[model samples]
Target: MALPSFFVTAGRRWLKLALALGGAAIAQTIPAHAAQPAAPATIRLDYLHTGNATVEQYAVERVVIEPLPWPGNMARTVDDTDRGVNLVEVVDKASGKLLYSRGFSTVFNEWRTTPEAEKTNRGFEESVRFPKPEHAVTVRILKRDENNAFTLAWSTELDPDAPDVLRKQEPSALRPIPIRVSGPSPDKVDLLILGDGYTAGEMKKFEATARRMADQLFAVSPFRERAKDFNVWALAAPTPASGVSRPSTGVHHASRLGTRYDIFGSERYVLATDNRALRELAQNAPYEFIEILVNNDTYGGGGIFGQFSTAAANSDWAKYLFIHEFGHHFAGLADEYYTSPAVYQPSGTRIEPWEPNATALRDPANLKWKKFVAPGTALPTAWPKAEFEAYSRDIQQQRVALRKQQRPESEMSALFKRELAHEEELFSRAPERRTVGAFEGANYEAKGYYRPQMQCLMFDRSEQFCTVCQDAISTIIDLYSRPAQR
Candidate 1:
């Protein structure tokens, strides 16, 4: 993921200019950042992504010079892992040489799949961040075409020294609490735990919850093995209320990040669409990833790759929620479950999915995760799909009824526990449970799409990731943090 070394001398020259402009003034505002070697200043490009189901467009918003230095390893400035729905390339304008690149997904793209997009157009604010380059750069946004190949969607020219660039930002009263410090910012994966719907008086509780969630996340595989390569920070802007909005229940609260449930009419879904507010709060901390904790007890959460994830901090299944959603946000792992209703409409033609875990089984001879498949394992691996789906249908019905009756959160939690137990017993008996072959019924469809295993965190409330998911996560971990010394 390293950027080409040829631009080192030029990068350093702009790094100095970045420091002079506003980096020096904002130094005192940074919290718990260990002293490290000089790095380039962070530049963010904000824009409006407007579209409907059939068409989309991108327009430039103002550019901003963030308060912090680039928190990623300078050596690993480019992203080779093609995981997200969109890819960004930063190229030197005059030389046309690639300087930096990354893969990420946006709320706008996700919305395009929903039925609402077919009915009416909508716009979402989005942003992309990278290190400041020495020369004028052309920022190109590439999106997946019909065949899942990255095609240029939009491109814009940027000049760092332009007078219109936002060079200064007002200081934030909130200070990020260092939850876990591994090393200098540039050397480790920086994860910012932002809290929404917590009052000023509940800041201590927010920190405790953030720390607990971080511990839970690392307890899972891959992350547990690479725990030392991460730095975790917690921050929250005090809100007047103690919980985020849940429109289905007619409950609403004013929160800093605008996180809430009932996104796209799915009662369990939660997300924050305010990109500006999210970036403004996150800029205070040195972060490459973010997970927002809402101070509510509802079993709701959501994640978008390379952007952020949110979890209901007080939910009984908070641990599962934190890890499962992170799989989507951190590594672009698609959901393996299909019985539950989703906000997105089903695709008429099931081409191969861009996610690492889910596949359309287009080419059985060259399945992406074929290396992990056993020699004699069948291509379309067999499992108790019928039994599992039948049970899931009943459980889903009960789940919907609970929300319809406005049942207590405790009832919802109990129902989930029962569902998990039944799935465990059902999947354990299948001979193919431990096999790594194509399992039918995944990615929100009961047919076409396939998953690598019978069970996984992406598939259900399982405790561990499937082999394919584990490898995918490890790839991302390596991208953000250096490998452990031999």
Candidate 2:
């Protein structure tokens, strides 16, 4: 009636592997006298999101069983936050019972807004991951319509135990290094910080940079207050070169992740077009969220909700870039600043965005974050808009001239510091600068859109998020991990 010696050894090996995934803190949490919940295999559905401005389509490419077990909290399988432009739902195919769901945004959604998408079709490789199911299920991809209603965009039947499913993969030497271990992954928010453009010799440097940023991230509100509810991991496969490509500056490198600047014709935008490469290296880590750090010194980064975010690790504003982009990726918060350059062509109509922060303000009486707004504050809150616009216009001109003349990155950094200082001084004098009043000139528009606060980390190069943003972020934290005791 006793287990065989070989079987006992194999069970011990699996225990070690699971412990390694969580590091010392997690391993210690497993009591010697208690039973542990069985971890399920991670299931990933890879597909293509192809479309233009007017239409979109999805097609399944493959199904994969990742090497690591599911790290998400099985207790919180349903997402009720109601964020993101798209949602994925897994349901029992036989009984029509919802099994799991999560809201997410895709690169295809961002590209559809670009001018190039108006004239040509583009495709982005995308993937949706979830805990493997017990039986055959129907996977549904839902998209929001103009009125903010979700409709079934695509659906397919899937069998987790299918013979053709990709269950085996060649082992890679890469393993995630524990940057900060707080608890077991299922009970904590597991964040993976990936490094691109880092050489094998710079491995230590990557760890240092990732650790520094992770510390900084926890220093901010919401994250700061709930730091113990999260764990941080760092991973990178050495690249042949030391920096990612900056095509706008005519400097190109063979970065392993295909991350580069000049995305969508925006000089400062950075993104990784190679989703497969990004996901492959990422699966080696136990993570529910990812923030990639590029070793380049350029002022560029990008984030897509449910996909990932990238940040320039060596920029003067690297810390700010790390959190701001992560805001987009983590909470689906929208940018509030209107003066920055962008690649998307304006649609000129203000429709309510699904993002929690920005608003169309068509119904001012029912502002999305009205609960935070003080009574009697103007709906289209008045501020020194004219002066701010004038200053921003001048800064934009100087910014263009600097890039055109090939000015040093230091010069640009200094320019940004000066600009932020000017705005801080200007807004500091306002009586309601910190109040949660709807402010015009958000969503990259000079009009028709509003923001919950006059300035925020999403609005400017500020250090902390506004009260409304903080609340929004806190909501997501509650969804991922248990609420911090008051």
CA lDDT, every prediction? 0.87, 0.86
Which residue window of length 10 is worst by lDDT in model 2?
A: 3-12
Per-residue CA lDDT of candidate 2, range 389-478, in tens? 999999999999999999999999999999999999999998889788889988888888888888899999999999888999888887
Cα error, candidate 2, residue 205 (Å) = 0.5
lDDT of 1 by residue, 1-486 (tens): 444443332333323332333253323333434333456778999999998999999999889989877777777777999889999999999999888899999998888989899999999999999988867999999999888899999999999889999989998776778777665566678899999999989999999999899999999998998888887888999999899999888899997888999999999899997899999999988899999999999999999999999999999999999999999999999999999999988988999998989899989999999999989899899999899988889999999999999999999999999999999999889888899999999999999999999999999998999999999999998888866411
Among all candidates shown, the one with the greatest lDDT: 1
Best by TM-score: 2
Q: What's the alpha carbon RMSD for model 1? A: 4.2
TM-score of 2: 0.95
